[model samples]
Target: MFKSLLSDRPGTEPLAAAFRACRTHFVWAAVFSALVNLLYLAPTLYMLQVYDRVVPTGGLTTLGLITAVAVFALACLAILDWLRGRLLLRAGLRLDRMLSSRILARVVDIQARSVGQAPGSQALREFDNVRTAVSGPGALALFDAPWTPLYLGCCFLLHPAIGLLTLVGGLILFTLAWRNERDSRPRLAKAIQSNAAAYAAQESVAGQAEVVRALGMRGSSIARQIDQRRGAVAQQADAQLTGGKYSGAIKFVRLVLQSAALGLAAYLVVKGEMSAGSIIAASVLLSRAVAPVELLVGAWPGLVQARSSWNTLVELFAKTAAQDRSRTALPPPAGRLRLEGVTVRLPDTETAQLRHAVLGLEPGQTLGVIGASGSGKTTLARVIAGALVPTAGDVRLDGAEYGARDGDELARFIGYMPQSPSLFAGSIKDNISRFSSATGLEAAEVDRTAVAAAIAAGAHEMILRLPHGYDTALGPYGAGVSAGQAQRIALARALYGDPCLLVLDEPNSNLDQEGETALMAAILGAATRGAAVVVVAHRAGVLARVDRLLVMRDGAVQLEGPREEVLARLREAPPAMVAAGRA
Candidate 1:
């Protein structure tokens, strides 16, 4: 209900709800701040008493007592300020505890929906920014800024002239702060975008260092990445320069106005209007009044960035909400699958990559999808594997729709190996077992599963050849292993648990003759065990063992039949058509 009622707040429902959950901590922080601010007046009041009463009365004992009282008040003020900081820190921890998991899940959803378009790492960084703003000086400034008017009011009680001066100074500093925000925001935002792009480019190039090195393009790549960083740095410098000007002007105005208040108070003192105590007190009061505003001015950029991060999170959460996923369990699934008129369209356009692709597979059946470059074979495989939700049409597994099913549960039932092998940094067994250790499985059970999968993919012997065998560590993108070795291990990962539906997109692309034999064996092994298999390949020769064949051209299926018939037709077709089908 909060989600619907808080339409104006976008993603604030969960974040605000967490704050409400931690309201007690915030309340104590606010209370501590009030006490701290109240105690701030003690020193001024003590000076006034010393100047008006102690000095005139020649009572040294009374001066000693007042001094002690002022010292105690200051001590209490320091303690309360410390307590407030702890409270804000605790509140930040509570917010992180309540929302961190959900934020990460949203990141995964974004990446799975569109790879490399909106990076999930950005989501993590944004969450960290929001968390820091919640606990850092920015949040403390918000609590203290409320006391600005109280200080100004106290100054007014001292003298209307002094109050007026402080007010003008505040307005001037505040105007400068507003102008700083207005002028610097655009440049800062551009810098942030530029930095994100540069970091992304750098990571991409580093991950594919082998490709760049082999092509002898490392120098050009480094120069391109450096140029991206240079642009970000230039924009950041511009923003800092713009903000520095306002900061300097605000500081100058504050210092000058503080002295002017002292001058005015002194003149009044000489005229027997106000006491000497009032002069010193007025300066202290003016500084207190504007200090919160100054702190806020310094923290304006961070506050703005935190708010932007929150908005992005809101948009992301809305798109990926799964309210009933945990509450309602899906029916038990079998390998039986169907894609009725499935189509995947290009973004912001009507061009479909896979148009009305209708297909089906029963348990224990093997289907080979063959096509030339730019054909729809890969798109179809992605749809079948549940990686890409079709732009149109229903993908049915048993009686349940694929898109409507829970992602985690779906993973247990489907196995998909993409054209590229993505093996994370871990032991070879960790990658092949999908990090099953995190599932709290016993070591023996995990090892059993890992070894079974490796055997299925013909990678057990290859893994044993390594220094640590299954326990060997891999760098990012499986750096410790060769490309073919990584592919074989990824195949093992896909084959783990003997998933009911298995889809391999170009499984043999990185394989040698021996690896090709293993690839054929893995597909046949899974098929024999009642898993429906779909193998997408550019080279039709590797698919000779498939039970059926499918040919795609221009996002549409051109031929599909018994494997022998399809192969025979390709041979008799036009040379261009034959090349497209067999290439």
Candidate 2:
């Protein structure tokens, strides 16, 4: 079901899709906005009638009737204005619902493929900007902008001179808005880039706070962050300064034009070409006509940002769409693993991290991998666990290539414990259950499986000693737990649900002697349950129960075969060579 949801081609662009979802609400908003603008003319007309007819006749009855009509018009205007805002709010919410999930998924995909930090973490924020731009007062102003000519036409009806002056004022404000957009574009783009860099630098320092303090590099780290921040602030300030100048100029032009138009209207009135009513009405119409342009000037920066963000999201989604396309689902794997000519090269370098490495395993078998650091042991373990895809080779389970099945589906059958264990901020049960809601599992089932897995990994007793036992709330990175305790919990997580294959990379690195015994027992128990087990170890204790041994040197396999035979051969080698081999 999830595969189909992600794989289907969106019939339209993401932004378009979101807009389409809220099309009805937008339509209602546009209609109401138009009504509201139309009603705006009522007050101007009322002033015209009062000056031209009411005062001239001194008709109290006509005055009362005109006042009643004006009040009614204003009441309708208020209702329409409220309706527009309500519709816009609905549209914004609908747009969010339509786009947020897809964008978030794209972000996760980008982060997974990135070698360093991905800049797409701000995708949701960008999406919010787009939604805001669509629903903001600025957008409503743009909608009303097309009606500017109507207001100008009313001014012309009042007097030609008044109409001409208003037209020129509108043009000047538009010119200023255009200039603001042009000047702010590049600066805003630079500011965004620098801000992203600054954030990345700050996150790096936060992640390595312990290392920085240990090496006395805190001052240098702080200096680097400060430099990045300064760059961002400088670019942002420059953009703001440019935008501010244009905004000020536009405001000044608007005020001068309004005063000039009023003067022109008064002169026309005195010359008998227009009336006192026409002059007041013309001034009101002039303000109404220029309002949209003023709004456009104010919203120029946000509009540009939304455009850039939209383009970035489009490109990101296009890149990841093909990878997420639907594939044929395969039945569950049976722990028969194969790596045919597997090879992996390090990023940005020709050197191989794993060179044409090949291995196979059957159910109920345990393979122990041992070698010096950088010998591709961890890499091979990762490949088997489906954590890393080989550059050239096929990894298959139960005769089905890895690509034939979904990653999440395959993950259910594979238990992977990396060298450095990490946990989320959650209860012990949640961590052990691998955050089951992500897998669509029931709460009761998650609890049952979590307890069983904890027992299988020999972590049940240790967990029971905690203040809250399985309900203990862990801080980020599993704080409040010792290294040994965290490792045991991670092991329990890997063993959850009796997975068909178990891949352990230095699983016992932080374990005590008792922990090591529990680890050996877990390995044996898994093998007895007809599961394939792969252990990457640096110590001999983990090797005692393995059925087979594979030794690695550099990026290639150095030795393989039954554990007894490999151990006998290693014992016969010279002492210095054996010691170096162990190292």
Candidate 3:
């Protein structure tokens, strides 16, 4: 069963290549282990020989000589074992880092659909499990596997029958353990999934701390949910324990097989087919086999987990990223975007969110996209920004086919701010620069210009009072900043790139009137600088500032013209008309 669990799809070329990079250390380690084993074997054989000689001749000097030789051999074995173990450990650690780096790179390259579909915990856990597998049990398994057979072969040469018997016994034990491992694979996979779900549920409760506290149902409402998840985790732990027991049972069965082999060897010696010296030597070899067998048994769980992790990692490595060809060089946008029969569809969902939507925006134009929540406004913006592919349509930037260009280059031409912006754990300067090394602006440049711009955008004078000013440390996940401050930081990051067009999803959110005024001024500034802007706004004051309004109702343009014209039309009809049109 244990053997079966380890029969994963062979590792890929990259993993093999990673292993090869540490070949020198592995070679030296193996050489040292072989020398130690040989020294260990010599002392055992000499002791057996001395015993037979002493029983017949009663030689004292010969016995003393044997004792000294044994002591020397043991000393040599100890030194070699220490050296080999250290070499192997160093090599294993190096390989672990190499493989981890490659895996993370692949993870970063993964497509949106695959990345989104994969649970975050699963992706992260796989790397850790595989690293332990490769660096710990994996290294030991590799060395012991070949070394066991070599040591056993020496015994076989001295007594062919004994060597053959031990071989057969070991094989049976391995087979039993492999089978147990195989049967546990699916159970382990399911257990991992269950654990992930439980963790996600726990995170949900923890993340919404304010809501749970404000509702004052913490002791009564969430307690039941928390208890349910805890029970599920306990059940998963029980399942893993059951699998562990199966492995233990296999080890016990192997021990019985080894005992049987030893008994048969004794029978051969008694029958006179084997010499007493050979019997003694065989016994020494058999005792040595115990270490190898136990090593394999102990490594079984790590190998099995590693196998599962490798399977997932291989899939990740083999993935072909979706083609994103929006990077071709194009003339800077003259503030014009044309969409022909644009449609937006989700990869994992059945329904198309936006159907055959048509729209156009000329240079210096400000389009306002307004609709009830979940009306596909955000999806449409994503398509226009080239972050997402339209099911059927072409988005032309300044009359150039958008898809023909490079996606990365297109990103450089447009400033896209999603509903929520992510900030790394760093100083204010790092948040604004986002570590972009795009030729003209470096981190220091962003520190001077971008930091002030972001503060100006959000009317954030309070930021100046921070202990380190722009260099103040932000906690991981931007915990040090407020929602409004983070948003402005995102705005600063967007502006740092000096994009030709701006797309803001909810720029007016979490801002006071003064902050809103700064945001409007920033948007107008971009337009005056020859860049067009498209905004998704709900605030009346915010909507009134835009040059034009493209109200999206049911994923289609409802009323698009000058801002005053659309606002007048909206006023003539009841507010419910906008909701009904969107529905």
Candidate 4:
């Protein structure tokens, strides 16, 4: 833990900027706390001095005055302490807000493919770590720095010998705590990764509950996930326990040091080497000195955790958009998409998903891509839509290449819908509009378009049967909606954006006969409206209506021609069913 804190970049400028922004109020609050502590310290000194001097001299008047002043000081100290607490609380809240905003912006600015390509749970866990760092470590740092120095200075002024002793003890404790933190950090990071894997296991089982039950592996699957999670938690708990024991030992050292100082002071008073008043003042100061040490020891672990989280956030935000960094000075898209010898290989897969596969489409021309499972149809769509850059070759959108343009700049003209579509939690209208701020589209206008798109996708009748029409709430990832309905909602969203080119990857994969027919009509409708459309078709019903088709196999185009000729060829050569279901 000590190593983690010591190794971290001291005082990040972003955090410093946040501190400076709120420094005025925080400084005043620190001053108030210091004054309160001083006042609280004064009373012990006054009582001892008066007893040592005035009682022996029989001066009751001086005693009474000192007593009154002491009481007043105590009251003032209480009020100041209360005010300081309020100020610190507000300061913490503001720091949390600042960090939260910055982290959220960083997460959004990260490239979509970088996040999406990660194992789903790992990305989510990384975000959780970022949030914890912001709220947990960010707030603690604000309250700690001022208090440590304040009390340390007070101790020195009271008695330098005892002050040095206390400071040495604090240093020892801090070193021990730091070591513990450093040792625990790697374990904590490992636990976090393992827990993410366990979560993934649980989600996988839940998603395939029917299959698991059919195979009689429901109990085994759940048990395996739970056991894995338990093991991870146990490792984390062991690290925590070891760290706690070391922390406790540090606290014990503090107690012994404090006791020895008090004992020595009493012995000196008895031997007439030190005055009773001096003993009293030193004891008060000693207590103040220990306060910061105790607080620091307690806060060190949180600091390390936050640093670990900060590293994760940095890694997440460092991804360049569309996985390319060479492109500069982007040009406008001209609605034409050309895949010039494009190829992609899955990062962790041994086999290439695509290999130097070339294809192209002119402006306002629809091109349907057909392939067997693992034939790289969706990979081609991703490359064309500028979501994934090709491992080899380049995609040109009109005269300008995709690699030369920014992801957002290219995305404005090219829209894409994946085989498995995910939706946010909101009303149907909100999901359909994607919270876009385009000037002409309002909530009502989006609702109207959503309904039209749903009807075109053969989802309107099902949506109307729900509790509300377009106003209905779709739970997270459209949980309450059917698979087909979720697909329609995604299609609606993509259609509502009305991009120059639409790349739909197996859009009819989850649809029924009726739904497939409606979707095919919608594709034709989009083409009628001059929006170029490219679809990956498996069913014969949707394939028969397309203008042209390109057949893909083993990561390259096996055939390409007019739709009628391609269909005739496909009819003559039927692919195996098990080999054709990519999902």
Question: If ranked by lDDT, best first, what sequence of candidates would result?
Answer: 1, 2, 3, 4
Query: What TM-score fits each model?
Result: 0.94, 0.90, 0.80, 0.80
- Model 3 C-alpha lDDT per residue in residues 279-349, reported as the tens digit of each score: 56776676565456567656766666677776676666545223321254567667588888887666587
lDDT of 4 by residue, 1-583 (tens): 1122222233234445555666765677758856765686676678576758886898988888888888888889888877776675666567566656554534443433433454222444454443344334333344444565556676566556666876787678768767777777787677666766787778878876778999999789878987998988887787678778777887788778778777767776787766777666666666665665566556655555556655554454344323334566655454676777777766667787778887767666677887777788888877776766666787777768765665555666776788787777887767776755344557667667677667655667767777887778987667778888888878877776567788888888788877777788778877776777888877756766678788878778777777767667766664652244212
Clash count list over all predictions: 0, 0, 22, 3
* Candidate 4 stretches greater than 4 Å from native: 1-40, 43-111, 115-161, 199-216, 320-334, 386-393, 400-412, 435-441, 455-458, 564-583
Identify the superior model by TM-score, candidate 1 or candidate 3: 1
Q: List the residue pairs that clash in candidate 2.
A: none
Query: Against the true structure, whose TM-score is highest?
Result: 1
- Measured over all alpha carbons after superposition, the RMSD of each candidate to the real structure, in angstroms, is 2.6, 4.0, 4.9, 5.1
Residue 375 Cα positional deviation in candidate 3, in Å, after optimal superposition: 0.6
- Tens digits of per-residue lDDT, candidate 1, 210-269, equal 899999999999999889999989988898899888888888888998899899999989
Error of 4 at 256 (Å): 1.9
In candidate 3 the C-alpha lDDT for residue 121 amounts to: 30
Which residue ranges in model 2 land beyond 4 Å of their true spot? 1-16, 117-119, 341-352, 389-392, 437-440, 552-561, 564-583
User: Which residue pairs overlap in candidate 1's backbone?
Assistant: none
